[model samples]
Target chain A: MSYFVSPIAYIVLLVFTVLSGVFFFIYLEGFAQVQFDTRAQLFQQSFSLTEFVLQPYFGTISVLLLLIIPMLTMRLLSEEKKQHTSELLFTSPITVINIVLGKYLAALALFILMLLFSSIFVIVLYLKGNPDPGVILSGFMGLFLIGASFLAVGLFASSLSQNQIVSAVISFGLLLLFWIIGASSDAETSVVGYLSIINHLDNFIKGVVEVKDLVYYISFIFIGLFLTHIVLDSQRWR
Target chain B: MIKVQNLTKKYGNIVAIDNISFQVNKGEILGFLGPNGAGKTTTMRMITGYMPASEGRVEVSGFDIADDPIAAKNEIGYLPENPPLYDDMKVTDFLDFVAGIKGVQEGRAAKIEDSMNKCGISDVKGRLIGNLSKGYRQRIGIAQAILNDPSVLVLDEPTIGLDPKQIIEIRELIKQLGSERTIILSTHILPEVMMTCSKVVIINKGRIVLETTLGELNEKLDGDNEIHLKLEKYSSDIKAKLSALQSVQNVNDLGSGEFIIKSRQRNNIGDEIARVVIDNNWGLKEIRPKLNTLEDVFLNVISSELKQ
Candidate 1:
């Protein structure tokens, strides 16, 4: 509720919703135009609703999340530090792990709320076209995993500093680092390529739920939360 | 109920608080008095386990803070210099959150109400904390601090930045709360200690300068009796005559028939001074013993330490 109360959260939500909606509509219109111009060719080719809509929708949502998740999480711990309210929590009976988990869960809850709103685009596609519900579910799952991973990293960034802008910048830099690492990897099948979060999400986008992809995202989330706990605990010593 | 043993805190090489130690018995209010940068806040933070000390131990209700932080923290309620408040949260909602986090599972509503009423913030329960005044916010801070009814309360400058009336009200509230739990309140204000605290520990330059009760402080100040006399008629010879007396060690004229006569020992020399005034016909209007204030003690201790 505290995060939702901030006007920045609403602004971020609105911008994300509008941008994704506009891009989804443009993609749908372009696809419709292509179908009209080459209806015979389109029918001959293997045209998939998942490829036409769900893929683009989930891909666009990931990019939007890269920008929006940091804003959602920057104030999680930074505001408490800035206002000197962290002292209350530090002195309370709660441990640093509890504080870190509590704030991370709150940010995750906000991310889930945003995901629910973005599902409107998927619902629209489901009604307008015969998209596979299974594919759509997998895509939604991938989007959620990526968003949660971003949120965890952003939460760790928030714990790093008392300045919200610094936290946001750090989170953005980290997410962008993970997003672009696979592109620079020499081999696509190499271990280095797996460092990129976007690489792992490819399987989920194609409606394939590989155990390796699940482990990648789950590890990312765990590492982010663990680092956050360490940072929060270190503050007590200083 | 609260015992701090040789609590020393250092930030890098800078000693924020030197080897300082004090104890607050159950139901006692210990005034943590100091000037700015005198390590009062650091000491309180160490006591509350908000931060760890470099080389000492703090025990609250027989639980060592460093070894058993959760158990010790559970026994304490702390209010930092600035109230730890969520400006976006309403008073009731904020207190409810605090109550929940503090693990007050049963009778939570009653506990919140009791704290709000005790801090005189029941009227602002429905208002946003951001919309409230500083005084009200401070009351809300106190309200949250007392929510769990901890055995010890640590307040860092509770009356700071408050108006006189608000300061008095908060002081009264602190006094009322101190009746049930041990409290350590830090403040740079002198008379606040004299008025509210039962005992005071004055710290200067990261060290404890004095730890004495208010009654003992008054008695100590009164022991060095100095008579202040104001007379209508001025006489140059009155000083010599007063100094010539057996009890008078020194007599200094403070201009316009006002004289300060220092006694050789702790004795009431008002009658002796009156006799001199009558004999010399100096028209004595006012004559009284000047009691040393907390300001005097504070300055004396601080300055003496600086000289050393």
Candidate 2:
């Protein structure tokens, strides 16, 4: 299908996959070289410094997902609406919900396929060195949640207008607000901190997939997609 | 069948279609005629649910445009003033996309073939829309609109910008399509309306100024025939002499030793005017009668209004 075969999707996938793989390798090398003194007897008798270095890896990947989701979703409805292909879509019996869902799924499917291809990094890590499989799976779970949440926000941005650039900018702006609020807040401002998508991924990076984090991601996706649906519906009125 | 009652469309304070009403029966071609800024396209857009009316309603095959837009849109096929086309898509792929969206539930390939064949763009189906000629592109546009085989077909300026031959071919195609389906076409080409539409509605300044059957519109302006006379001896007495004749309604000197005379009835004015010229010992260089035209009626109405 042209949807999967398009070079834009391939380029985004390659860039993100390589960058994350490089981060994973750097984290492993940093752990292997670091010399700890009394910290070795502080808590765990046998815990890999490699895993601790990779802790920030999942968080960094979450940030990468947020940064790149707009590239995948900016073209969904905006391109069709801009090119006037929307008339072909609108006059058909297909409802606005289906069009929105079809495009969203198409983008997500491409993203997931790319993620599958990058699982080679995980396999290589297991072959070359010993790492906890549970932590790896939990990191993947966090990646999926972060990707879906960002994609929903990007889709909502796409629904606002017929310009792909505008959609990408708005999606990035919205996600950056959430990421900054999640990182720089204390318990007193925990409300804003809890709203952070990266905050939800923090527990996952620590090999803990909390139900509350899952709910947060799902609710974020739901609200973003719900707003996209409303914006598309309002086009008929315009 | 379609009935638009008291249909008014306004963009804020500016009215686009003002209290317009018209009916299109089954299997008839209705021509919507108006000037550049007329409400013809606006009315069509409203009927197709591309836009909504500010007030009133349109019913297509008994389904209200606003109350039941999906059903009404399903029954009607619309080609807008500018064909909404995707340049990146191949002609066949574009038509397939249109068929998919138009909800052609069965025999989609066959229907697409039929539409392409009807529009005579089957040969260019493999080519991207941007690479096609203007005439072929227009055909693809029409092909997409008719892909679903809707009962009511609406076309706006379908033959616009086509060469003379292409225009005739498209006009003939529209006439053939009108035989089985109800058609509403808006065009500034008066002769195309005369040849294709069974009835016509003329609008001006966003208002329906006239609505009449084609035969009625033609007959209203029909004054039988006109005679052009060329005389070697030019004189003011010629007008008085032609006016006194039984069939002559009015005579105007063209200031070039020529005159145009309109007859009161649909009689052969060539022989009568020739006889009069010979009897008056006038050196008649030419005597020819012309039939009534839509242009004549249009100008007559506008000119009379200007005179008042």
Best candidate (score: TM-score): 1
Show where candidate 2 strays beyond 4 Å.
Answer: A1-7, A10-57, A127-129, A187-189, B223-225, B230-246, B264-266, B276-287, B296-308
Chain A TM-score compared with the true chain A, each model in order: 0.94, 0.89
| All candidates: TM-score | 0.95, 0.87
Runs in model 1 with CA error above 4 Å?
A39-43, A185-187, B278-285
Q: Write the per-residue lDDT of candidate 2 for residues B1-308, one digit (tens) a residue.
A: 88999999887688878899999999899999887887887888888877778898899999998898788888988887767777767787778767767777699999999988888888988887877777887788788888888889989889986888878888888888888888999998888889999998888767777788988987775555777788998788887898888988888789867998988876777777888889999898877665667977766665564576
Candidate 1 C-alpha lDDT tens digits along B1-308: 99888989888999989998888999899999888889888888888898899998999999999999999999999999999999888899999888877889999999999998888889889888889998898888888899999999999888876788878888998898889899999988888888889999989989999999988888866747898999998878888889999999999899998998899987788898899889878887999888887788889988998999
lDDT for residue B279 in candidate 2, whole number 0-100: 95
Model 2 agreement with the true structure over A1-238: per-residue lDDT tens digits: 1255346777888898898888877876666555354576576566574365556677677767877888778877788776666765665556777787877788888878766766677767767767788888887888888888888999899888788999889888898887778666393357877897778887887889889899999999989889999988777665
